[model samples]
Target chain A: MDLAAVVVYEILYTIAFLALISAGLAVVFGMMRVVNLAHGEFVLLGGYAAIVSHNTLGINIFVSMLVVAPLAVAVFGVVAERLIIRFLYGRLINTMLATWGLSLAMIGAFTLIFGPTTTSIKAPIGGFAVGDYSLSGYTIFIIASAVGVVLLIFGVLKYTRAGLIARGAMQSADMASAFGYDTSKVYMVTFAAGSALSGLAGGVLAPLVGIGPTAGLLYIAKAFITVISGGASVVSGLIASSGFFGIVSQAVTFATNSVIGEIGLLVAAVILLRLLPTGISGRFFRDRL
Target chain B: MTLNRRQFVQGASAAGALATVPSVAMGADSIKFGSILDTSGIFEAYGKPMEKAHILALEEINAAGGLLGRKVEMIPYDTQSNMALYTQYARRMTRRDKVDVVHGGILSASREAIRPSLRKAKTLYFYNTTYEGGVCDRNVFCVGTTPAQQSAILVPEAIKRWGKKIYVLAADYNYGQITTNWIKFYAKQAGGEVIQADYFPLNVSDFGSTIAKIQKAKPDMICAVLVGAAHLSFYRQWAAAGMKKKIPIATTTMSSGNEHKILTPSEGDGIIVCQSFSPQADFPSNKAFLAAWKKRFGHTNDIHEIAASSYDGVRLWAEGVKKAGTLDRMKVIEALESGIGYTGPTGKVTIDGKTHHVTHDMHLIEVKNQTLTIAKSYSQIPPSDTQRVCNLEKNPNDTKQYEIKI
Candidate 1:
């Protein structure tokens, strides 16, 4: 019974892990249609912000991770959107190339500033025992934060006026502009919000992993896989695909090892995409926000 | 003759190309020392310190006097932690630069990639990092401590202190695979058994499920051969789960990149490790090396096991050149094979003639409060693992790296 409970907890943690890493990319690529090749670098910037602020400037770890990291990276997003992303919006191939170059530049800049070695801070929380096993208390915090972030995104998009304008703009920018909504301004704000979400994910995960200049490369593929597998509906697709991939990967991990577990995830994503053509939410949750 | 625009351009380009042939043909008075390492990517934690060691050794040698009465010219190429660059730069160093001796390659794959080219080019090579054993080639000299020198001492000691059942977690590559086999061999030799051996790809960072599985297995001790920044999380996650106190831990690759400093005390404390060198040893040579390093680099914290070996590698090669009294490749190899010894940062390092590998000291260490505490030291341990399969004295033409099977 204790073993079963531990497995379930691991499966849920995996789901939360996928959902958190994919949230920002879902907004940027799924909603905004930007195909941000620099999304991983944005996440890395958030991690660095948290580490630098906490270790050097003596900021509280929580405030540094949750508040300063997102705010600082969001401002960087605004500048990046204004300078480069705005020019290549309609051209898909150009956006990919430009953002790819931007990613390289960010890695170089980070190496210059922080050096190439890995740096990290200690996890704020400790472990608590459950039956025969002790689990990291930080894992529970990550799972809860992932749920809260998803609901917040849903609430804003479903209920607020900015959410309505953003949705309408995404559906038909010409029509929304004709209604005097300033669609370009809407895009700018939306991109900033997406960047903020990625920053938050990075900040939250910094303690659990090592932070380095190339650390961004580690998560970019996993995030892209989860976001693409999630399909067009930001929240529901993310939840469904995260649930599916997380369960498959963790179950395999329990059975075998991490290498095969990761392989299981990639295999499931390929099969799911081949079967549904779009994604899980594309077929099932067709109208979900 | 009046030339057309295309003919004129072609003639000018041909002249430009023909003008650069003299430098390659005419050898300079200085002996070129070619170095290739990954100084700026994910592997920089290891590569950067090794590069610094090379420079320091060269400066010290030149300060005393040039090797073979000629100045040593360093020709460095940064591979940027990419494997493809290894071949490209190796070719350039041998064919274009025509260096006299080459020294670099951090990973085993990188060493294998360029070993053949250097051997064919007749340029002497020195690989200076602790790695899995069983590399046999007469053209190359491996100066790092091999698995036998380390795990042979570490495993039995850990088993006696802890218990018989061991769990092995290793990075999933040639290094990790071979090292895990060595651990198993040593464990069995000590009348112990390995309960489970898990291999993780170098990039797999999450260890929650692995930790839970380990708790369930409940081994007497955990042997971690995990590598790189990503694998460092295993220690953090293990500690976060409160398993550090429950089970004793032993490692073979922890402080190779100075990971003990990167990890907090709560995460890294109480883990036992064995390696060829550490900055905290109590030897006079080690103290002098640390003082010299502080004087030159302004800090002594970055001097890890491999960096010390790298510095020793350069000085040992210089000793060979001095003994040979010539820059000829065969003469220098013969000199090195004559069993030249040096007392460097690591105590009493000497070249084993038959295996073309080094014999050096290994230490047992424990991490506490982000510093290594040296508990015990074993002097002049040999590359016995490689020596078993490789004997250059018997078969000088042997170029095959025998994969040792248990």
Candidate 2:
């Protein structure tokens, strides 16, 4: 029974981790249809921001992770959108090429600023007992944060005027422009918001995986896998696919080990994509936000 | 003769290429010491200091009236943490520069890339880094501690201090796998049993499931043989789970890259490690080395075990050359094969002629407040693991890295 609880906790944590990392990609790619190959480096930038603030500036851990990191990355995202991403919009291959180049540049810049060493921040939460076993309290925090981020995104999109305008512009830029909406402004804000979400995830997860210049490589494939497999709708699609992956990956990890478990996740994704090319939301929750 | 513009340019370029070829072979009076290291890119944290140590050692030699009463010149190539570049640079150093000796190769993969070419050219090579032992090559000298030098000392000592049941978390690579084998061997010999062993890939940073499994197994102690930046998260997650207070941890592969400094004092404290060098080591030679490093580099913060080893490696080769009184590769090998020893920063590091590995002092260290404090010292631990499989004295043509059978 104790083992079962730990397994459940691990599954939840995995689901939350997948959801957290994919939230921003779900916006930029799922909604805006812009493939930001540099998504991982943006996350890495956020992690560096968090570490520098907390470790060097003597800031509170929460403020550094939640506030400083997001703000720093949001500013960077705005500049990237204005300077590089703006020109490459609507050309899928060109956007990919530009962003890929941007990824290499960001990696180089990070290596120059941070140096080539793994930097880490201690997790603030302590352990809490569950039956005979103790698990990280930070796990619970992460799960909560993931849920909060999803709900916040859902709430904004469903209820706010800005979110509606942004969604409309993404769906049909010409139609939105004809209706007197500044679709260009909407794209800029939406991209910045997506980058902020990524930065937030990077900040929160920075304590778990020590921040390095190439640390984003660890999360990039997994994040892209989650977002791509989520299909059309950002919220419901993300939830559906991440739920499937999180359960399978963690259960396999428990049955065997992590390396095989990772293989199992990839295999499951391949089979899933093969069967439903449009992804999990393509079949179910097609219209639900 | 009057020539067209294009023909003139081509002739000038051809002449320039011809001129450049012999520049590498210039300075016939000095010995060309070819040094290759990843002074940039991903492995720079490890390679940068080792490069610094190379310069420091060379400058010291030059100050002492040079090797063989002639200036020992260095030819450097930055591999930039790329594997392909290792072979490319090794070939360049051997074929073009025609360096008399070569020193450097951080990762095992990097070492393997350059080793064959260096051997083919009959150039004496020195790889100064800690790794899985059993490199049985007559032409190569591996000066770093092996699995036996570290895990053999750590496991039994950990079993005595903690209880009998042990658990291992090793990286999913040859180094981690072989080190785990040695740990198991030493554990059983010391009347302790490994409750479980888990191998993690270099990029597996999330340890939630692994941590929970460890809690269920309830091992008396944990031995981490994890490596790289991603695996460093294990230490952070382990500490976060409050396991630091419950299960004592011993590691064979921590602080080699100054990982302890990466972790906070609370996270790093009480971790047991066995290595050859610690900045806090209390010895005259070590002190002098640190003093010299501070003067040269402006600080000693970047120096690690491999930096010390690299410094010693160059000095050891210089000694061999001094004894042989020649730059001829065979003569230097013969002189070094007489069991060359150098008491440098790591304290009396000697080359075992049989295995081409080191027999050196190993320190039992504990981490407290992000500092390595030496608790016990074991002097001159032989390269028994490699020596069992490698005997270059009888078979001088051997060139294979044996996997020591448990």
The TM-score values for the models, in the order shown, are 0.95, 0.97
User: Model 2 off-target regions past 4 Å?
Assistant: B1-17, B20-25
Candidate 1 lDDT score at position B130: 91
Q: What is the TM-score of chain A in candidate 2?
A: 0.98
Instruction: Report per-candidate TM-score of chain A alone.
Output: 0.98, 0.98
User: Which residue ranges in model 1 land beyond 4 Å of their true spot?
Assistant: B1-27
| lDDT (Cα, tens digit) per residue for candidate 1, span A1-289 | 8889889999999999888888989888989889899998998898899999999999999999899888888999999999999888878999999999999999999888988777888889898888999888888888997998899889889999998898889889999999999888999999999999999888888888868888888889989999888899999999999999999999999999888999999999899999988888999999887
Ten contiguous residues minimizing lDDT sum, candidate 2 chain A: A113-122
**Tens-place lDDT digits, model 2, residues A46-146:** 88889999989999999988999888989999999999998878899999999999999999998898888888788999988888888899989889989
Clashing pairs in 1: none
CA lDDT of each prediction against the hidden true structure: 0.90, 0.91
**Per-residue lDDT tens digits of candidate 2, residues B220-297?**
999999998999898888888888899999999888789989999988999999999999998999999999999999
